[model samples]
Target: MNTFLNPFHLMKRIMLIVTLLLIVSCDGYQSICGLVIDSETKTPIEKAIIKTINPKFKAYSDKNGYFEFHNVTGFIFSDNDLTVVISKVNYINDTLNIKNGDSKLVKLIKTE
Candidate 1:
């Protein structure tokens, strides 16, 4: 039987291609989450701005110092490094190199 003429075989091939595409595309997006805290005081730093430099995604730390960015783009399986900047008033800015789907604890020092 010619494979092209077989409806079931064609369907299977199409599904396989679609499945591969989905798997490959899944690696391109990821979520980032972290907590911001005062380095000296060990206290949560609220209202801190957290952002990714390359993709320009931003989120603010809540009262609990938790921030998250969902479905951020440009992160693939091979190159998943992201640069994050965290800043708040009176606090020295912090820069971090983190991977996609990472939850990190960040500490910021207060400027004298």
Candidate 2:
């Protein structure tokens, strides 16, 4: 049987195209990393919460104000934008939008 004229071959080709299309259509996840700091003092804020919504998750900033949500759970599927909220005691919460392997420096203001 001519491969191109075979029914099974046609079905396989169609299936391959459909699979590739689905994969291309999806907005995939990525690794997110950043730092949280005090707006006034320009110092790192330890133990600050970094997170997202819907498929919610929370990560804490280390003593150096560094935080990371690696590709595994930190996966965000949007228009290449991931919004994360950062909060800690005595500090006003802040939000950050990280994109495509981009890291950020988030500064939170202190409460009076």
Candidate 1 Cα outliers beyond 4 Å, as residue runs: 1-27
Model 2, range 1-112, lDDT digits (tens) per residue?
A: 8999899999999999999888767655677788888999999999999887534778999999999876534323444567788999999888777775778999899999
Given candidate 1, what's the lDDT at residue 50?
93
Clashing pairs for model 2 are none
lDDT of 1 by residue, 1-112 (tens): 8979799999999999999898787746777899999999899999999989988998999999999998888736656678999999999999998887789999999999
RMSD of 2: 3.6
How well does candidate 1 score on lDDT at residue 54?
86
Question: How well does each candidate superpose onto the true structure, as a TM-score?
Answer: 0.74, 0.75
